[model samples]
Target: MKKKIVLAYSGGLDTSVLLSWIKETYDAEVIAFCANIGQDDELKGLNAKAKKTGALKIYVDDLQEEFAKDFIFPMMQAGAIYEGQYFLGTSIARPLIAKRMVEIAKAEGATAIGHGATGKGNDQVRFELTTAALAPDLEIIAPWRDERFRTQFPGRAEMIAYCEEKKIPIQASAKKPFSMDRNLLHISYEAGILEDPWFNAGDVKYRDYFTTLSVFPEDAPDKAEYVVLDFDKGNCVAVNSKPMNPLQVMKALNKLGGKHGVGRVDMVENRFVGMKSRGVYETPGGAILHFAHRQIESLTMDREVMHLRDSLIPEYAKLVYNGFWYAPERLALQALVTESQKNVSGTVRVKLYKGGIHAAGRQSQFSLYNPHIATMEADPTKAYNQDDATGFIHLNGLRLRVNSQVNGPANIGG
Candidate 1:
């Protein structure tokens, strides 16, 4: 019996060629799997295309709800942002796709899983690490890392020529300036023209290259728009008083945020692969949700718990970005993060204006923000005693006073 390989196929130029190449090179039957995590029209005609490209069968699963609920929501709750700017839109999607790919491999009795992610990129780590964590025995076939494959297709031009020779239908051309990966959470652009870190997307010559889910801030509406998000246990449950499931919440927010150009990030980030790469992303809905989630957290979460979780944000973000979603450390951090959100049920009103997200108001049934205790006016209720602060300050400053005396007044200004 021929060995079977389940390939992560996107029906894009790289994967289109990969599907055919894997079958011919390995002398194996290739099964194509595409996870439909909010790709919208990108999922169209993939089944036919995959089979025509030599796939024995194709599995295109609709994973949007699972993506939003199981993947995107938990990441948001943990406030996992890569390098403090990236929302981890692309990073978070990898584990879910790889998880499904592993399942398909097991179900089909395939001995290996294949991906088109280049060896130089983070997705290669993300996809392979996920497979390693889940199913260590299954072999991972990365064509881009294969010397024979690289030799044959040195660049996009070669790939296109190979496609034409094979009579494989592909929409890619040499003139295309960048590559994009879009799921429901975001659309990320990198490579090609984006490889130049100094290239300005705002320039009139290149203005049209970067946007998909959002308009440029300069093109947004003149007036600010207000959006109210309702959360239960840190999950966004509604938008503007309309109850919605996780999927609906994302869709609604994406539309609102896109209109105001709320989530466009262009940054150079250190990839887990030990290289800095430039990435441009549009995460309209995610920005609104992250801001609103933090606002709600501020109103409801305990002080110490919030601080502790905040300290773990960078570590958690690194694990996710580096493809350790199923690792024990990440799971342990997730447990703590989940506990911190128990009281984080609330509503947050946000103002969106030309790429800015502002927390206008936030309220919760479990709100810890006591306005009466915080007020400066005469406190007839005496909710907080002003006299107690004098003693508290004195005790806290005792060490400082002793250090100053012993150190000869700390040599002010040297």
Candidate 2:
């Protein structure tokens, strides 16, 4: 019996070539696996394509709800944004995909697994690390890093020729200048023209051809759209007063946000592989959730707790970005993040317009915003006495006063 190897196949040119190469090189039976984490129509006819490319069988798992509830919500609650911009859309999905890959490999009694991730990118690290963490004994076949594989097909022309000779059906006439990774949360575009940091990623030529989730901000409607999101313990439960499941909530938000051009970002980010890459991303639903989450946090979260969590945002974001999702340190950090969400239940009304979302209103039953104490209109006997500030100010500034007296005030016009 031939050894069975599970391949994380995408039915793309690279993976299509890889499927045939794995079979020919190792004399192994290849079982293709595609995780359907809400890529919409991307998975359509994937099984047929895999079989045509010599796959023994194909496994397409619908992971939309799990992606949203397990991965996205936790990251959102942690406020993990890589480099203060990216929502870590691609970063957060890898571990879940690898976890499922491991499960399938075990069930099928496969000793080896393969992925089409390139050696230069972060996906290779994310996939391999998660696999190592979950099932270290299983062999990981990374074709991009394989010397034989590199020698056989050094470029796209060779890859395409190999596919043609093997009778593998490819979807495109020619290789695209750019690359993309799309999931429920976002669509990311990078490489080729985008590799040039000064390139205008949103130029009209690329904008019309590439944009699927959103219009350009300038092309969005003149009027703003209002959306009300309801949260229970930091996870959005409803939109516009209609209760929805995690996937439905995202779909609803995506529709509204897409129309308003709510999420678009272009940045040159530092990859975990020690290289900077410029990419453009559209994260319409995620943008809405981020804005709404902050609005609720402001009302319900304690000030000091928020500050402490804010301080850890960069570290937490780094872990996800660096493929440490399954590491002990990330798990421990996430515990603190989960604890901070106990009272983050509320409704946030958001105003969405061209490329922006503003929290118009927010309220919670467990709100810490006390009106009487915060109000400017004062009663002499209110909880916060105005006279108390005189002593408070003097006490707080005593060090400054003493320093001035001791130094005899430095020269004013030096």
Please give the CA lDDT of all the candidate structures: 0.92, 0.90
**Per-residue lDDT for 58-148 in model 2, tens only?**
9999999999989988998987888978989899999999999899999999998999998999999999899989999999999989999
- Model 2, residue 74: displacement in angstroms? 1.0
lDDT of 1 by residue, 329-363 (tens): 99999999999999999899999999999989999
Please give the range of 10 consecutive residues that has the lowest summed lDDT in model 1.
Answer: 202-211
TM-score of 1: 0.97
Query: What is candidate 2's CA lDDT for residue 287?
Result: 88
TM-score of each: 0.97, 0.95
Model 1 ranges off by over 4 Å: 411-414
Supply candidate 1's per-residue lDDT for 125: 93
> What's the lDDT for residue 407 in model 1?
80
